[model samples]
Target chain A: MGQDGSVPAYENASKESPQPRPRLRRSVEDGWIAGVCAGLAHHLGFDVRVVRATFVLGTILLNGLGLLAYLVIWALTPQALDGEHADAPRPAPTSLPRLDRAIRALRTSGRDEAFGNVLGGLALVVLGAALLLERHGVNLRLGLVLPLGVIVVGAVIGWSQLDRAERSSWLNESSFSGRRGVLRVGVGLVLTIIGVLLLATQERGWAGMGDAALSALAVLTGAVVILTPWGLRLWEKVKREQAQAIRATERADIAAHLHDSVLQTLALIQRKADDPAQVQRLARAQERELRAWLYGGGQSAETTLAAAAKAAADDLEDRYGVPVEVVVTGDHPLDPDTQALVRALTEAMSNAVRHARPPVSAYVECGASGIEAFVRDHGDGFDLDAVPADRLGVRGSIVERIERHGGTARIRRLSDGTEVALTLPVHRPVNQSLNQPVNQQTLPLKEAHDA
Target chain B: MPEPRATTHGPIRLVLVDDHRMFRAGVRTELDDSLPVVGEAGDVDTAVEVIRRERPDVVLLDVHLPGGNGRGGTDVILGCAGTTTESGAPVRFLALSVSDAAEDVISVIRAGARGYVTKTIVGEDLVTAIHRVADGDAVFSPRLAGFVLDAFGAAAGEIAEVDSELDRLSAREREVMRLIARGYQYKEVAKELFISVKTVETHVSSVLRKLQLSSRHELTAWAMNRHLL
Candidate 1:
């Protein structure tokens, strides 16, 4: 029996300890007639032949009740191959009897009207039986049975109509005012009137009318219940459409916003295409600005100072066709001030590519307190003090742009290369805001340098 | 660059669309002896109007222009083609641009331009590109062909898989990829790496196949996206 390779290792371990009582699971490999007796023997730690003999004796002694019990056990216990092992007790089985499944289906079907119709039909059958019994002088009450039958029919019709109206209420209210809603109202009124008339024609005249009026009340109550849900659903649908319309208008506003700002900037760029250098500078600066704005100005999780520095270096290399090696040390999200700092670094890189020779590199070091960038080039070094005033490439683009943002720019001349270092505090200065005109500040600096 | 071929048919009619008037004039003076200029427009709207009215055999299109609703060259192509070609025989567009940026190249090519060339191209090469595009053969500036291949050949989702393939490249192959992606000419890459141009070509093709990339342009974009450059 143990030679079966299909039995998992855990099953063997389970067989060694029988005190805790392993769960009952059908044996797939070793079993006759659905493995019920073998499974029971394995779980209970008894000889398989003894369990089988007991089942047979019990079946004969108990008038085949034991056979019925065996069938029930076979249906209830899941196969061990289905991952239900004797050592591991599973949660309550999901496999239900056929009768339980039918009850569950009826409860969860969501067809309330259909259920009501079925109950009404059964009531009608009972009413008809009672009427036949009365004709044979079986003493059945015709008045009670007839009124009950009329109420049940009215209620069923009201229920079905209400369910349909509620479902259709998602359509516009104007559409609901068409023939369908009116037809339902007319049918409900007619049924309610018929119920009242039936009561009036009962024996004892006006007093019988009172008793039959109860059936009319039931019909009216059912109709009200149907209409109430329809009204609520219609209200919800109207609210949803209003919200949708508001969102659509908001989207249109955003589209117009993009057209006014981003599209206009693009048009300006295209107009300046004749001056390739100006276009390149504008395109690079505008791309960074737009990315900062569109991505919410450093609020995005991915926008780090190191990433911005690397991108600026890459752009400069591609634009000028110069080789730039960028080394970034620390990473952190950038504020608008630091974004300006990065743009200034880009201008410095471009100057290095333009004025300096090949083998240019940028080093960026960011910390919690401040950030610094050094753009170094391996060209003939130039004296910073001797730069011409009209050469706004270094003065206007790098120095003033950084200084205006409460940062510092320093130029150092090496024996064979020049390095421009920029530093900025983590927080903006009290006097500096994002809207400050950096260009206006740079214009005066250009005049001072030129003078 | 290829040599200009003698045409068996009549002079290839052409329209020039560029925002820069000087550039248009330069191209006109260079190619006037070979291909006759039939029409011209500075922006997308007038470009479409002139190309449709003239029914030119070829149109030298610029990638970026004002007006035409901010879409630039793609708008001109669409305005002329609508859903399909209006002239029965489709009007071919040869994109001319100063920008060698991959996005600019890929966007115009995706909009169905017959070919693309940078403004640095000499007059003879420009004429050759025009002739090839008129003959319904695709032409591209050497490295620009890689952009078209990358945009159309590989699915966008497969680009993420390129990261794993980067590990598969040998050390020498990695050096060639970085240089090529950095916008180096094949000869320049060969010179920089001290290898023959043929050896560089072999390494490039091997690297492209291993990375499942279609062209050098895609390799550049892939490297740039991974920050490997």
Candidate 2:
């Protein structure tokens, strides 16, 4: 403890040195006891055995002053937490170093049993010294004193070496939670009863009973003092975990917002920069879309078939260079039917633009029982039978797509062009809901539309 | 109706039609002083009225507009066809559209447009096209000519009779002719037929003579008119 005050002076000397300083920390990897010789050898750039031999020689020549100095250094130096020792210079092999190596081998042989062996060795040494003193007519009793000193030294080493969390858990394995608290109280009460009964049975009177009671009260108070701080610390840890979870959610929201708004707008600007008119149009459209998304304007309940058809036409014109003219007459259809019809119409219109000459026209009308649409093109038409099997534009996209929606597609060739007329039933079947399976129906006129 | 005399040295009378005002102004500024802008209109109704009132020699028309069922250029062309010069010469229309789509090209050409050029065409080329259309010669952007040929060729399939001239070519010459008609360059035709460029040239000359055609463009037009492309 007296040598502990000199540690900061050595740390300061190492910091002030311009040359690379070998850190003067205790070498737990290659050390006897507190590794004072190993630490000095590492700092002074000498072999550890050379430092140990110098210490042994100096202690013999200086009449035991070297041994006291060694103990002081051992108490002062800190263990090198990072176990590395290669920085120091090596020395020539000598007999003394060889003897030190043999000693290290013996010390490490039963390393796992080292703690109990060391304690037992100290007890034997003290007992032998006491017996020798008694034989020389000096009375000494070491039974309780030696054991208590050993315990005190062990506690001091443990308290200095263990980190904070490990020390806390070692102090209270059963934290002051409900079940453990009840168990601890039961054990304490049983011990107190046993202590009081022992005192009464031993013919120790009221004074012994009072002493036992006071000691019990002191133990309970000590437990309360220790457990209250631990409970507060555990609560703080839980709160910190909750805060981290909330921060993660907030970061996710910010990422989503950047992806939707800033990144999408930048991509649009890059794609449409070649044409100024197109760039302007895209900017205006995105502004409206963003504002609608931000201000909660997209929640309107009414989505008409006509408006949807117009949007699909515009999208087609934007994607493919073909233009379409759509004319919608009468009221909007039911929402589910409207969606189905819009999809079917988009497919038919896509077919017309791809296969036929365009300037295509779409006419939509809603009647009492059903809705109808006609997509017409004035291109050079083909024979219905002549359409190859691989051509899905007419057969699959137009006919099958409409039929899947409980609708019918009729293709007829006029003298100048071809027209596809689609009719969708407004009401579903009696037993079917909006989300029911598709109804597959066959048309009678398979050989139609020779355009 | 009197025939408008072809004046060689004078500027062609032109009416510019477009929905975008800035685009119209840009075109007006880009055109040389030789081709004067006679009038401008944004929609189909106004365009037709302006064309009839002005009776310009060439009408530069945009294919899409707000009025007249959204087929603005075709509508203007069809409307002008009814009111011609005293000599029965129709007002020539040159479609100037941003869209180079096959459908737009074919539809306007079918509606009596004498020429079609996309908006990407530079000022000099557009001026040349206007002059050619005003002179009663068909003018088209190179790719747009293909669309025109396809549309009119398929329409005339029933009326056209088989020509013995195509049969006169040898098989190798015929292959060269088909490739040349489809707009392959001479070197491309040579590589495709696994023949030398000189051999391809020889075949082309022979095919041209047999068909009584003058150039590659004429051969393409003749083949398309016969629905052979």
Candidate 3:
């Protein structure tokens, strides 16, 4: 993480900063029952083979529980995740603003979400209506309404929950089979009850012959209607290509470290602390641990610096009661302590808040090495000589701060009010040394796919 | 280097808070006779609980602590950052830290400290700083003073002239000039100034011209250089 955590490492260390995070969507060509696995693998930067292998291993280990789970994913997952649709490549790293504009420009993405929610609401309504009709002695199987109603409800909620899983990255996990089972049983039982009600209506209304034809038509139409949105996904295609490219650029040693160690240790650390000191110690530990992990005996590419700027923001909020707004724009480790510097920044903020007779705007910037905090009160300025040597509101707080850190802090009267600034040394991270480009030992992604 | 003694401003009931037991003991030893000890705490959590109970007028704080003891747990600095006196009551903070880390100094102060004096402060200075902070006057050690001056200089451009101005005037000259600047004429300046007109004139002439100005208007302008007007 960046030395203090005020900065996001991904924006600094990664060669691919300009790229925004991927959205989950359908993929067309690599359709393993509508590309749910591919889309998930692509979104989270995992190998589809590994994801597929994980599912395979689990199926074997669990006596084919995994395969049964896969079939359910095939049934319940919204078909739009298939990659055959969207034609976009992974946009270049520098194209972020344009990408956001592109996303905003695309009316279809919002339209799709709106369509899903509307369908979900409609599905519930129709299912309720058909059951009511069935109770009223109207035949829907020989009739057209009841069975069609069940499919409609199933499609709507099914798409909705699938979207949730997409947003959460659940499908990328090796335990997805287990997770999908939970997803299905909960949703499946409800949908199954609706199915039985629809069937009950069938027995009361139409003959078996007409009911049979209508059921086939309903299934066909249901599949077609669900699959139509498959034409609009953007995340799927871009994710697949970039993922293919990353796998091609992958160093085996780096991949192994990421898979076998880092995440597990971080999960342990996240669980261990609740207070600032614990978090600070853990953050420092993360820095050292991540460094050791990076240079460990294995050959490595640049360490992944996906560490967030907001984690630092959260830490600052927790300890200092200071609100920090972070705008991440580079690649490097953004650790937890960097955010806490806002407390230092609020030296300006607090002076303005507590003592400014006529309140003025104060602006502050915090970074790894030091902080610059300044406040201007709109009220008035005073004589330095007449003013007592023991200026408490400021010198007690603002100026002494720099000395405490072996840095610098000061306050001065402008034409209007006082301004203060402080700078402190930050622990420099090894990731900074990686600013020099090194050749990535390319991965076998395209080779694996082409083969 | 002078030994500390109890002052006439009543007991500045102080709490010694730091994770380092020896350092806390040393401060307690140094200030025990000069300032009454309400309690002692060594971690953020316990320090917090102690300060809440004792309500000491002054908290002597250290920046770093062990056992998750630093920052907010029982630390008075962290606890007091958001706290203020209820209408009228006195609770102040004097930070005692070895760290000259700028960020830490700034943080403790922002976290509600009233003064910052280093651990290296002599027995007398530390006691004096504690009393001053308790009495609602903030204090900083000389080293921190320089840093603050540097920060101020950097922040609002420069104030070498103020120090230069002080250097240019003698003590008596400053006194005479103060009266003149307060609107006293040569005779009135001489009366309040406790000097003869020739002396006031000499002081005023030196104050005006040496401050590099030609007239009383320019003298006032030079005196008011920072725009306090």
lDDT of 1 by residue, A1-451 (tens): 1122213322343455343544555664456655667677877778778988988986787555456446544433444565445443332343333443354345434233233333433443344334433433443354444434444433433343333223244222434533665565556556555554554345553455455446545455544543443344335545556767998999998788778667876887799879876665666556544544454334433277767776777677557756465555445577777777888888878888998886676756554566777777767876556666655555676777777777888876654566677888775454535545455334644333110
lDDT of 3 by residue, A1-451 (tens): 0122212222242233233434444342453444545555554567666767876885787555455444334333444433433543432233234543343345335434434433433444454445544544754333344334344434543454434233223223323534663554345444444444444555543455455345444443444344333322223434445666777677675677665556665676688656655654555445434544543333232231212223333343445433332221112332322322333445545554344443333333333344443344434655544544434434444444334444555555544455444454456442333222222232111100000
Off by over 4 Å in 2: A1-302, A318-321, A367-370, A390-397, A400-407, A414-417, A424-445, B1-22, B25-36, B39-229
State the lDDT at A41 in candidate 3.
59
Q: What TM-score does chain A of each model score against the native chain A?
A: 0.37, 0.32, 0.23
For each candidate in turn, the TM-score is 0.36, 0.29, 0.29
Model 2 per-residue lDDT tens digits across residues A250-360:
999878986987678779889878987666556545543454455433444237786677677767766665666555544474476667678778877887788787557
lDDT computed for candidate 1? 0.59
Error of 2 at B155 (Å): 33
Among incorrect, acceptable, medium and high, the docking class of model 3 is incorrect
Off by over 4 Å in 1: A1-190, A193-237, A244-348, A352-451, B1-57, B60-91, B95-112, B115-229
Q: Write down the lDDT of every candidate, Cα atoms only.
A: 0.59, 0.56, 0.46
Model 3, which residues run further than 4 Å from truth? A1-451, B1-12, B19-36, B42-49, B63-89, B98-112, B119-125, B131-137, B154-229
Instruction: Provide chain B's TM-score, model 3.
Output: 0.59
Lowest summed lDDT across 10 adjacent residues in model 1 chain A is found at A1-10
The TM-score of candidate 2's chain A against the true chain A comes to: 0.32
